[model samples]
Target: MDRNLELMLKEQKTAFYIFDSAVLKKRIMHLRTRLPERLELCYAVKANPFITKEIENETERFEICSPGEYEICKALGIDSRKMVISGIYKTPEVIEGLVSDKDFCGIFTAESVRQYRLLCELSEKYGRKLKVLPRLTNDSQFGIDPEELENIIRERDSHPMIEIIGVQFFSGTQKTSLKKFRRELEMLDSFLEKLKSEFSFEAGELEYGTGFPVSYFRNESLDEDALLEGFSELINGLGFKGRIILEIGRSIAASCGKYYTHIVDIKSNKGINYALIDGGMHHLVYYGQQMAMKQPFLSVIGKDSIIPDKLWTVCGSLCSMNDIVVKQLPLPEIEVGDVLCFENAGAYCMTEGISLLLSRDLPAVYIIKENGELYRVRRTFETLALNMPKYERMD
Candidate 1:
């Protein structure tokens, strides 16, 4: 066990998430070093926006989807130009805010023809010549249809403010196979070439939202070298150079987080031994509804002396019987006072947690620095009672 982890387990008895900023920085550096020089790495703010002051300089750009996400980026001191606004829904106020900022050079993706027109409308009204990227969402083609793309371009030409810079496409996620991504690059080439041949406007960038899979439960590691090499070959072979942006999320921050929960009870049911912890599915699963098949890597802190001979069914403190974290898991003798640590939880665990569910307290957040210093980001807060709201007029 890490010294900081052990200290945290000993001092902080409540459920908390420990984010290792060092690991996150290292992961980002590793990714940046491996990717082609032209490929710009933009951190998807939705993954883990909990940035520490010390590591704030490490991340340059962010991909935001909503006003809340944009606010998070602003809170992090990120420049407005470094945020690429994506997703389908954008409030008129948010659009106005994006267009009103004179220094905002960040890219916004339009998923539909309606969204593109909306951007043009807002930008023209504000008299801001904003750089816009067309996001492919034609489900049938897995990209923007050529006819619709031309229509959007024509509409933008009619309005002098908006300029079409590039295209953005996100087909699917959790990909590990290099061959699949190679095929995607090939298809991208075809699409780009088709756009060049069909349209008169010149596209300057190609932002491909892709990244390797993070090892949550299954440990078939991604071949990063092969993927980067293959991608480079594809880009160079095509001889189409403009700008490349790689939008990454979960994979970058997954390994940097750890969830700590204290075991409250140990019992035997039928033919299995159950170790119940204070944390539940709300902490382990993303949506706090479905059970994740990937068994989280656990550590029984300070209890490595005993040999593992028992198959214990580890469960959370939720009322539902389906709140099992892991079942039939081989572990050393788990006691009621033992601490259970779940690794690889940085990306989508805490934000997706149902803290108000069953009136449970929210988990505390801590950032473990590279020097083994634990910085408390957020202290655990108890949920308000369901009947505590006194503003009821229906009596």
Candidate 2:
């Protein structure tokens, strides 16, 4: 922990998230350098839209999964050419509006035939050629089937305004088996070869969503270097010669964020020490974590003193019993006003939590620049205003 950051945390009164811009950039650069050189990194904006601007220049492209994500980039004045419009349920109005824009040159991903037709109609109506990637799903509701995709490619001549640039496929996230991914890549390579042989259509790109796993538990140790090396070898051995776009999110942003919350109360119940914190389940989330049964990286920011460790079950301010942050962790002597800092919270924790449940106030957000200066980006927001509704006159 940096002394300056510790001093800044001591001055805070409420739970908040502090993002390190330097760490974010380093994570992006690490992926770029570690992965195969032929593979282009596409930062999934849904992972932490707040840091998109901080890493926009470091990544080759941005995977925009929804309208809100697109707005985030637009607000940040990100270049449209670097955007990859994606997601299964893309709003027709939003897609039309984006396609109708005069300067819109970003690529769009079609998950189904309906989306394909929507893009074609908009392309024809706007009198502009559109670049698209048809996503092939692994028997899920997310994307079109392989047969359906083949039909679309076979009839590509009918839609001159639409150009099928390549294929996109994403199974899921937090994957640990390299063998599973290898099979998927092999199947995809065979499909592309079939398309090239039958329709004489060579895909110019392949946007693969690498569901890279992020180690979030004490018992989990992922060999990230070995995984990346194996995946890179599998991709390089493929016969398809095209641009490779690896869509990543959680793995890149999780390490750059830290969640801070202070202990408000402490008590003993039935031979157990319970430490209550201002932040709870509504503010923190880790993939596949069940009831905080697994231990995550956390530390107590307090005065330097030698003290014996004791088992403490950390809970949150929420009224629900499920608001446990961690269960029975050994820690030094803790007192009220002692802040607990949680690491690797930069990904889905903020938005995935049930924020509006208890009408609790939202946490403040801060960013640490590369020069070690801290800046507050958002103040603690009141969610009661959003949860409450206007009273109606029944009389």
Best by TM-score: 2
Which candidate should be chosen as best, given lDDT against the real structure?
2
Model 1, residue 362: what's the lDDT?
79
lDDT of 1 by residue, 89-208 (tens): 778778778678876667778877777888888887888887788886536544466678767765666877877888887766577777777777777777777777776555788878
Q: After superposition, how far is residue 65 of candidate 1 from its true place, in Å?
A: 1.2
Worst 10 residues of 1 by lDDT: 285-294
Go through the candidates in order and give each one's C-alpha lDDT: 0.75, 0.91
At residue 91, candidate 1 shows an lDDT of: 82
What is the C-alpha RMSD, rounded to one decimal, of candidate 2? Answer: 1.8
lDDT for model 2, please: 0.91
After superposition, the stretches of candidate 2 with alpha carbons farther than 4 Å from their true spots are 1-4, 303-308, 391-395
